[model samples]
Target: MSIIGTIYEDVTTDVLGHIGSWQWLVTFISATLMVPSMLNQYEDMFLLEPPREIECDVSASSSVFNTSLCTYSVLNGTKVYKCTTWHVKFLWMIWFKKSWLIFCDHKIKLLSTTIICRLGLVFGCIIFGLIADSFGRKLAISIDVVAELGFRLILTFCDSESWFLLLIFLRSLFASANIYMGIILTCEIASSSWRTLLNAVVSIPRMLSAVCLVPLANVAPNSETFNFIACIFSASLLILLRWTPESPQWLLYNRGIPKAEKTILRAAKING
Candidate 1:
């Protein structure tokens, strides 16, 4: 009776922390290690003795990763900490509140969605590529970004699992298409000598964003927050497009000399 009573007391005290710790814990475990085989460094230390769980100090953490590492070291081995299931912080919770395992209660369904999204990309690339070639890069970009933004906004309000899946497919389609149109525009606008430099310059922001995403996610941890951010960015691009002209090369190739020449003159005047 004494042992059971003590165990129950401990369990009641520890339950809240475990439940709330998921957000930071998942983030830390997902971070890329400087050393891929981080466990190797502690091989000597862990060879004879496995570590026991120590109390995590939350006060010293600058980010979730720090908090997670402080909570438990990898040296403790899998037995001390194991993620049976995961949670997605932020707007992801609105739809996926129960489990990150996702709907249909099977891993295969999740895998199928990923496969479908990838296939959607293939069709998106081919279809949007031709659209950009047939119409203009500016128009294609505007169409694709607007569609993607709309889908993301719709996703926030979606409750039905089937509709959510469909929306994801649509978002993937538009996202892939937008990427193709963006690449086309970049290559079409830059001179041959400056093409490489233009590509590199444009890629820098994407790379920086990719690097900072996890940390930013820690701060803004909602799917809705990111969706809003994307919508604002897309809207800003639309506003900026008002001042920009259609690709002169696209006009020269697809339209006629007169229209292309007019666009160039307008652009030159704007620049001056």
Candidate 2:
């Protein structure tokens, strides 16, 4: 896409933010932020420090099922337990050792963050749905932006598994709401003929953001830096919102014809 194409898409996305394209980027970053939490699954399996030579006394155990009866020891008189040194390529699980997955290899812990994220999506939809209905699309998006940024900022400094999980849930909730609200606003505001093109254009950013995650994770020094980057990107949207206008349709329906007409007229003047 050319600079003009990028500008067009961005302008279109902001215009549609009340109804459509802007949320595509929100969804992308939101989903990207949550991905780091699940990195522990890979870390637990592949990134742990290698254990020293192990001496297992299984000769005393006659049953194959009774592995508990077997006694094991480290040849160097040191116990090989949870990993202290991470693979370094993954780079950040060391900060999260107090979390449940750090001490034990539980399958439930592996799935918990993903599961919580889904739960947040469900809750976010329900909550933001009502908010958009009661307030207006622009206000709803503003709230989502703030919530996502604040939670992500907090997530950067978070150490506990519970706090990390909670922040992700909160952040994803806003993410889901932002996507839903943005799509609705776009669909509501754009002409019926132009809707498809707007949606396709916005989706490009979402795909690019998804592809950037691997490099983002690899290049970031730690979870804090990773989250800080997300916060900065999210904060930039606030500046972008200055160019985004309120939805005339929403204004008409909720604030009456006068406000709606004024907004429409202002938009026309800006476009002209």
Candidate 3:
């Protein structure tokens, strides 16, 4: 099948955040961002006609009606009729109407968007591991989520489109810490016998996260609602961080002896 025409994505659930998980967080971050990423493209599926066409000239506006699908238009009519299932490309087109927003809002804040646009790719590096070493992967992931939550909250206030994109970039940064990288880190320290199996489970959440946003998208199904959902997911990810174990390997390598021992003890108590 042509990748371009694909309409829906498969959904699955397998979230795994380890005490020092890196991969899961990276995936989760990307998945979480994916919700808005695609949704941001939803505005263009339809088109419309002016009322004068309906009152005096159906033939004149014939081309406009036939030209688009899932659109909204008036042919000298009082109310607008939105077509069902507007094509998605139009969303990007509409944004350009205010293309100035791209530069005005945080969307193009130079370095930030460049750095953030690749949360999935970038987190594959050693940075997540370092975060795990200094802050405990769990805590580090938690912090990143919190920051993203705030990024979303503040994002709503931005009138500029450019700045909003910038905000999205920053949010992705935090997501990078909690998503795929976090998951990979967890699998690394999980029981070796079950590592691959559990790693597969970790990947599931990344998949599920997309579908989870579906109902959310349907509920309000608007840009504002979608952004709100993004923030909620970020916060939820942060809170769940407590359930994660501190990476024993991370502890052993960086803190040694007692701290590593305490980490194990802490895991027992939490699990118990």
lDDT of 3 by residue, 1-272 (tens): 00111111010011122323433343344344333333322222101111111111223454344332223456555554443222111112321111122211232353454444555326422465566666666666556666767876776445564566666655555545555544545444454444566556656655654555454344442344345556676566554555555555555555465765676555444434
Model 3 poorest 10 in a row by lDDT: 4-13
What is candidate 2's lDDT per residue for 70-172, written digit by digit as tens?
2233344555344222222122333222222222335576467667867887888788788777777667677777776788788766656777778778877
Candidate 2 displacement at residue 88 in angstroms: 9.2
Ranking by lDDT: 2, 1, 3
Give the lowest summed-lDDT range of ten residues in model 2.
46-55
lDDT of 1 at 88: 34
Of the two candidates 1 and 2, the one with more favorable TM-score, higher being better, is 2
Tell me the TM-score of model 2: 0.64
Residue range 1-272, candidate 1, lDDT tens digits: 00112232232223222222321222122121111111111212221221222223333334323223113324334433322232334433432222222332365665666666666667777777777777766666667656755876776555465776787677667655444344344444444444455455445444554455444433444444455555555554545445444655666655456876675555444333
User: Whole-model lDDT for model 3 versus the true structure?
Assistant: 0.44
